[model samples]
Target: MDLRHLLAHEVAAGIIATGIEGAYDSVSCSTAGNYPSMGVSQWEGGRGDNLLSWIDGGRKFIGRTYSDIVNSGELDELRAALDSEQGRAAQLEILAADCLDYVDALMPYLNDSKCVIYAAMWCPTSTNVVRVFVRNRKSWGYDVNNLSALADVFADEYYKAAAVGAMYRQGYSNRAYNTYNYLVTHEIAWELLDA
Candidate 1:
């Protein structure tokens, strides 16, 4: 039950179905995640500091906390920020940039990335060594057939924060194929089948 092997198998099926060339580079024996991004390797509790920033809108958004909006029924400075034209514009700008990056990551697969990567969860992390899958994404015309199988399998582990899990990757774009999401799905599907 090699997890990476299973991932490559299914992804091969997906690639064949899509008729695309190289959809991925290395199925490294590693995995990573990002909030609203990668899958939880472990059952992380309560979001904590990671979620705290998300609530405060430090990343793509800012302004109010779940409590402030859900319970207090009041908009904070950040929420108020979105209430204006500029704030909405800013958010859109950030989203647009993300989309651009995302598309760049998927450039290898092009139009059919969805069928292979799956639109529901294919999010590619930046072009770096994410946990294990060493992403060499810049190759313009990668024939996935030429790619070799991984020597080991990798997936995110989960438990309470008290438990262990792989550190997630950073920086993302909102382009065509989200490599992160695809990896998560690949990892999960392989784990379940292997289990």
Candidate 2:
């Protein structure tokens, strides 16, 4: 991957790791509706199963349920596996692929790296929502090049959608706002671009 894409992946991964796993090695069987989730981004369901297969040969917990693994003390084993260097690398690799896909999606609407990262961060949880916001903004002739303005539009769109019951969570707007502010405060996008 290019440096910009790599940096975007790293930033998004760190933010997602902080929000979900809090650590690279953390594993949770209950967070995602009792599905075994592992690593930084909580790769769960089919992704979680794929992660397990990649890291642990898929023999331990492929078809097994969460309760079976937990009762068999295999969850601890999974945690230990996730803590390994190979496991962390695998998780990051998968996360980077995911982040890059989001970046690609936003590139058509918002070319600014910061704005793209902000929207890409939401893709993990709300792909359709971010896509709609990007499409709407593009259709309205909004200036997507300005990160702050784009963020404001996103926040406004989020709230308006929530108000009309189009969106389920009011707090989700904060993610876009906070992501934009964080990028600006840290100059993350500029730094990446410079690199």
Candidate 3:
């Protein structure tokens, strides 16, 4: 199967086409990207994004919180570019920025940085909070067209969460990178084929 076309256009679009109407069609977007321990964020749209919306309260909170990281003296340059991507890409990028920021916020709660004093002592990497803010800024790019394409990124979060859990238990990661790498390859294929 052309996973790239499946992701970049057809299947991804199918998820949205069915999802926005509340018809409940979706694929298990992996929630990670290119790394085994990178963590996840929801990126499906149309129907898939709708599914995310069904369970995305936390995601919304993160977007606002990431903005706080930039605003609350954590870091600088947290502004969402309202006019960066062209057409649908702009919209997709906006959604991605929101979810990335939220997932970045989720990492700390998962890591329990509340007790790490170094988290509070350093410029960055000292705590999950600072780390997420930086990560989100870099992660949330401004060029995706179909917002549903976010499934590519979302899978990473789910995978990483699995990996971290596995690491703690038996020291074996969840192999999150596989799905991420697949999606990355898929997206690249999409750009070529769709073009």
Highest lDDT among the candidates is held by which one? Answer: 2
TM-score of 3: 0.21
* Candidate 2: C-alpha lDDT: 0.69
lDDT of 1 at 15: 32
> What is residue 90's positional error in candidate 2, in angstroms?
1.2
Question: Between the candidate structures 1 and 3, which one is better when assessed by TM-score?
Answer: 1
Q: Which ten residues in a row have the lowest lDDT in candidate 3?
A: 115-124
| Candidate 3 local distance difference test against the native | 0.29
Better of 1 and 2 by TM-score: 2
Ranking by TM-score: 2, 1, 3
lDDT of each residue in 42-103, candidate 2, tens digit only: 77788878887777544477666778888887777777787777777787777887777777
Off by over 4 Å in 1: 1-75, 83-85, 109-111, 115-195
For model 1, residues 1-195, the per-residue Cα lDDT tens digits are: 343333334443443233232211101111233211111111112322232243334333222333433344432443443334553344333333333444344334433333223321232222223211223321423332121111111122111111233333111222122333444454335335335
What TM-score quantifies how close candidate 2 is to the native fold? Answer: 0.76
Off by over 4 Å in 2: 1-4, 20-23, 29-34, 56-59, 159-170, 187-195
TM per prediction: 0.28, 0.76, 0.21
